[model samples]
Target: MSNLVEVKNLCVDYITFDGPIRAVTDVNFNIKKGEILGLAGESGCGKSTIAFSLMRLHRPPALISEGKIEFEGKNVLEMSDSELRKYRWQGASMVFQSAMNCLNPVKTIEYQFWDVFDAHDMVSNREESIKKAKELLRIVDIPEDRLFDYPHQFSGGMRQRVVIAMALALKPKLLIMDEPTTALDVVVQREILQKVYQLKEQFGFSILFITHDLSLMVEFCDRIGIMYSGQLVELAPAKEILQSPYHPYSDGLGNSFPTLIGDLQEMRGIPGTPLDLSKVPPGCRFAPRCHLAKETCHIKPPHIHQQNECRLVACHYPINTSDNRDQLPIKLTQVAEV
Candidate 1:
C-alpha cells in the first residue's frame, strides 16, 4: 500500500527559561493508506508531540525544531495559512486525548458539529449541516436527535463517540487519535475502538492511534512503534512486537502489560526513570534504564537499522535471550540477511 503520510527526521522542542528541551528527536515513520499505526510509550515520551506535529498543531512553546511532514508528497511544514486550513479537516483530522472535554459545555452538539462544517466551508445550508450531523450520530450508534442536546447531557463515552463523528465529518484521509479512549472503562474503550475500526473500514482512512496502552495497541493496530525518551526505539508489526520485541524498551513495555491468555504473573516495569530531556545524554536515550546496555550504548547513540525485512530498531544490542546476545553489537546487514 502507498503511504498516506510520511514524517522524516522530526524533532520537536519546548522553549523553556533554561533552554530548549527536546520533546521529540529524529523521529521518522509513515502511515500506510487504510492502515492503523499506534504509537506506544510512557508519559512524556513525545508520542503526543509527534501526533500534534503531524497536524501542525504544536503551540508556541513547542516548536518543530527540525522535520518534514509530508502528506501526499506535499510538505505540511511549508503550507500557507489558507492551505493549512483546507488541509486540516479535509486531509487529516484529530480526535484529541481529552475528547470529552473538547466539546463546549454550553453548546449543543448540533452547533458543535456545525462548527467544523462551517470552518471547512463544507456545508452552507443549515439543513445540510443537520443532515450530516444526524448521519454522523447514527454512524456512531447515537440517536440522530441527540445532536440537539448539550455536551453535559451525554455520558463521557457518548461524548467521545461524538468527537469521533466530528473528526470523520470531512472524510479526512488520515485520522490522528491521541488517547481517545482515556479515562473511560474497558468496555467503553473497546466499544469506542471497535466503532473506530468499523468506521475505518467504511471510510477507508488511515489512522495514527497514540496511547501508552501497548496491550490495546497490539490488539487494535496493524503496526506498533515504541518510543522511549522521545525517540522511536522499535517499529514493527503489532503481533511481531507482542511475540518477540527486539529492543529492550519494547521488551520492558511488553512485560508491563498483563496477558489475557497467561496465568496471573507480576507485571515488570523498566528499572529507572526516563531521561531528562533538558540534559539528554550523548548516546542511546534508553541506555540509562536498559538492562542490556553496555559501555558503547552509553557512549554513542545508535542509529535506526533494520533487523529483518519488516522490523526497525534503534539499539546497539537488541534484547535477545538466544546466542545473538553474546555477539556484541549486531550488524544490520547480517540481521537483514537472516
Candidate 2:
C-alpha cells in the first residue's frame, strides 16, 4: 500500500511561564492508504498531541518544536495558513474525542453540515448541501429527518454517529479519530467502529485511530504503535503485538487487557507512573519501570531496532527474547540511530 501520511522525528512541546514541557519526543510512524494505524498509550503519553500536531490543530501553549508531517507528499508543517485551510477537512479530517459534544446546541444538525460544506465550498446551494448531509447521515445509520433536529434531541451515541457523518462529508483521504468511542457504551462503541470500518471500505480512506484500549486496537487496527513517555517504543502488526509484544511496556499494556480465551484472572496494569517530561530522567524513559532494565539501559537510550521487515522495537532487553521459551528467536537489525 502507498503511504498516506508520514511523521518523522516529530516533537511537540507545551510552552509555559515556567518552561517547556516536552509532550512528544522523536516520534516516527506512518499510515498507509486504506490501512488503520492505531496509537495506544496511557493518558498524557502524547498520543493526542501527535494527533493534533498532524493536522496543525495544536493551539497556544502547545507547539511543534521539530518534525516533518507529510500528507500525500506535501509537507503539512510547512504549509501556509491559506494552504492549511484548504488542506484541513478536505485533505484530512479529525473526529476529536468528545466530538459528539462539539455540535452547536443552537444549530440544527442540517445547519452544521451546511456549515462544513460552506467552509469548503462543497455545495452550490442549500438544497444541494442538505442532500449531501442527508446522505452522510444515512451512511451512519441515522435517519435523514434528524438533520433538522437540534443536537440535544439525539442520544449520545446518535450524536457521535452524526459527528462521524460530518467528518466523512468531504471524503477525506485520511481520517484521524482521537478516542472517538471513549465515552460511548461498549455496544455503541462496537457499532460505531463497525460503521467506521464499513465507511473505510467504501471510501478507501486511511485511518489514524488513537485510544488507550490496546485490545480494541488489536481487533480493529492493522498495525499498532505503543507510545511511552512521549516516544514510540514499539511498532508492529497488531496480531504480533498482542501475541508476543517486544517492548516491556508493550507487554505490560497487552497484559493489562483481559483475554476472553485465557484464564480469566485479574488484569495487572503497568506499574509506576509515567515520567515527568519536564524533568525527564536520563537514558530510557521507561527504564525506571522496566523489570528487565540493566545498567546499560539506565545509561544509554535504546535505538529503534527492526526485528523484521514489519516490526520495530526500541528496548535494550525486550520481552519474549531467546532466553524466554514462549517466543521465537528475534533477529535485531538497526533501523535508525537514536
TM-score of 2: 0.94
Clashes of 1: 0
Q: Tens-digit lDDT track for model 2 on 210-285? A: 9999878877899999999899999998888877788988878877755666344566666788898888877899
RMSD of 1: 4.6
TM-score of each: 0.94, 0.94
Model 2 segments more than 4 A misplaced: 323-338
Measured by lDDT, the strongest candidate is 1
* lDDT (Cα, 0-100) at 246 in candidate 2: 85
* lDDT of model 2 at position 177: 95
How high is the lDDT of residue 264 in model 1? 62
> How many clashes in each candidate?
0, 0
**Poorly placed runs, candidate 1 (over 4 Å):** 321-338
Candidate 2: clashing pairs of residues = none
**Candidate 1 residue 303 C-alpha distance from true site, Å:** 1.0
